[model samples]
Target: MSNLLAKLISMKYKGKSNIKEYIMEISNLASKMKTLKLELGEDLLMHLVLISLPAHFRQFKVSYNTQKDKWSLYELISHCVQEEERLWRDISESTHLSSTSQNKKRKKTKGAAEGSFQQKKPKKDEEFTCCFCKKSGHMKKECPKYATWRVKKGLLVEPTAK
Candidate 1:
């Protein structure tokens, strides 16, 4: 999937880059994995996406869909498309086996009615930013990204935020 994502990202849509820029670009892959829910770590993500480029492209959404009961990425997408087509066709009978599935479809027919459950809600977590580094991980005041070469007045500043 990481390889596929790289192919997608690099599909001539991302413009251009160089060696140093690519290195720094690779460093932020961890955040990309977390945000994209790719279920991959930083180093491996970079290796697959950056290094493994063309060869693994076909692994993007290959096989996996067993009638014995199993699903793969491609299978899942095909199943979704089939279900959508069925809905579009307005089938009188459902193609799925689940009884609960029929119940939901019935409810969508209007005025069938249903009950909702009440439950305790968890408290939200507080979000914080670094004061020293003025960044998320480190403090704003101590941010290394803010450092400048040949310091002055025991202080340094970054020319640009990016």
Candidate 2:
């Protein structure tokens, strides 16, 4: 870092690099270094993240908040990181349900392999009747849609489309 700072200071303008651009380049370098360290250890980055906010209120040596009363840079950052960590933990816990879902799905597939999820329908009579339309030619076993149509019209409850 000392060597990099010395190099940056020793750099000549030569009408080639703008002053703002040079300063920004230095800033970018510093941020990259910080990011590398943060990846290595979150506590280090977390501490800095909490302390990054500005101190807008001060009463002599002590500070006070004029708006909501309580405030400080480090405290604000700590709160933010705490909330963020809590949110992440909640999300991870919720996704754990998906693993249970996968397990349930596996059990269902295993039950299916055992051939217990299916039932044999009774043999159809010579003549069948439609439950909804009340026709005699086709049975309710043939057309699920027609059987559900009357129920939907009468009670306003839709059966599963599938």
Candidate 3:
């Protein structure tokens, strides 16, 4: 019986487990202890349950503690069940909101990429004629003779377009 109580004290709540199921397990253990000629107080059992809750319920614990009226086991269970529902609802809503926002962002990014593509200027290449030499395949700034002259004049040479 002491071992069972020790186990109950050591048990901790996990977020992945159903909260109601966890409470049922506690009730079963307490009942077993009772059948063994040991009686556990309601307040002590409630406190034990509270202490065993996961860290995610820290805020709930704070709120519960701040309440003036001492709650019975049934009252605590009702509040906990309500809290569990609230927790799951918040999780589902946040997931849906995030997915919607992510899809919007992806569409915006795709549209921006397409817009930039259309705005891109034609590539400068061999198709262009050099203004200086009247020859094909280059620009005015890319004339070899002009570049040599600039170098001789101690002026920096402008790079030719490939």
Candidate 4:
């Protein structure tokens, strides 16, 4: 009986389980203490629950301690449960905001990649050769063969010397 009571007193809260479940577990231990002819009042039960809570609830414990308001077991449970919900809500909201921003960034990067898919412009220093005359020094525009062909086809008139 003493060992069970000690176990109840020493139990610590693990974050993996829900706060409500933890509270229920503590309540059961307190009930067992009562059956064993031990005195386990609501106030003591509340104290045990508060102390057994994880370090995440440090702020909650501090606020509860500083205030003049004396909360019963039911009121404490309600407040703790609300605090748990608020903590998770804030976490989920921040995660959602970050994911949305990441998606927007991904879309912008994809758009930039698509724009770059077009053919790249040739650099200024790079020279092109004439395909018509098979020459390396000049382009098709300045090729003699092309000039003669254009003149014969009447596409361009011969220039007269000044």
Candidate 5:
């Protein structure tokens, strides 16, 4: 009997199991204690259930404490189940948002890398011709010979040390 009472007192809801199941398990222990002539009040059992919940239920616990109306065992179970669903929904939404943002970032980086490669490869149909040197495979602005001619002609400024 003492062992049962100690077990009931020490029981904790670690969130590994379903909230309903955990609550029922605690109620079952309380029932067993009642059969042993160690009856625990409904209010006391409610407090025990709240105390057993994990840290994530801190807000729920606080809300329950601050409210004037008290909850029965069944009401407590219902509210806890709702709170658990809310918590799970919040977590899933945040996970989805993070993954979506990460995917967008990856696509942007991939597009930039592919764009750089595309820019480096010239189109087959467009043959570059240097207007100044009359040379194929090169443009006038990119022609080394044209640049030297411009430097000699004083059209292009030679870089000077600041």
Candidate 6:
């Protein structure tokens, strides 16, 4: 009898099952205690049900406490089911919103990187600067002055074009 009472008090809802099943399980335990000559009041049973719920039901518990009227076992089940649905909806919506924003940010960053790379690439008709002469229109390797200096220094053999 003491064991049954202790079990009833220590029962916790871990969300492994639906709210209705959890509440009914607790109710069954309370009924068993009653059969063993340990009578618990209806109000106490309601409070016990509330206490067994997890922290996710904190707002629901607070609302129940602040209300002027009390709820029966049936009303408690109904309200709890409604609150559970609302919580699930809120969770799904937030997850979707966050994922959508993340995808958009990735696309924007990818587009910006591609645009910057394209801007840095030189066009076919664009002029180049010669590092050897500090002039435009050709690169250092193709500079006329650099070729003459290389020929004078015997660093290059002049190609005879026919």
TM-score per candidate: 0.20, 0.32, 0.67, 0.61, 0.66, 0.67
lDDT of 5 by residue, 1-162 (tens): 999889988998887889999999999999999999989999999999999888999999999999999999999999999999999999999999999999999998998988953545458997887778898889888888987888899999864659
Predict model 1's lDDT versus the native.
0.44
Better of 2 and 4 by lDDT: 4
- Please write out the lDDT profile of model 3 over residues 8-57, one tens digit for every residue: 89999887787878888998999999999988998889899999998778
lDDT tens string, model 6, 78-149?
998899889889889999999999999998899898895354645898888788999999989989899989
| Candidate 4 stretches greater than 4 Å from native | 104-122, 126-162
What is the lDDT, from 0 to 100, of the residue 62 in candidate 3?
92
- Which sequence of candidate numbers ranks them by lDDT, best first? 5, 6, 4, 3, 2, 1
- Candidate 5, residue 149: lDDT: 86
- Candidate 1, clashing residue pairs? 131-140, 132-139, 132-140, 132-141, 132-142, 133-139, 133-140, 133-141, 134-139, 134-140
> Lowest summed-lDDT stretch of 10 residues in model 1?
57-66
Best by lDDT: 5
- Candidate 2 clashing pairs, residues 3+ apart or interchain: 50-77
Number of clashes recorded per candidate: 10, 1, 0, 0, 0, 0
The sequence of per-residue lDDT tens digits that candidate 2 reaches over residues 66-88 is: 33444443454454445445555
- Tell me the lDDT of model 5 at 48: 95
Task: Write model 1 residue lDDT over 77-107, tens digit each, in one string.
Answer: 3553454444435433444445668777776
Error of 2 at 97 (Å): 1.2
Deviation in angstroms for 124 in model 3? Answer: 8.8
Off by over 4 Å in 2: 1-70, 121-162
lDDT (0 to 1) per candidate: 0.44, 0.50, 0.85, 0.86, 0.91, 0.88
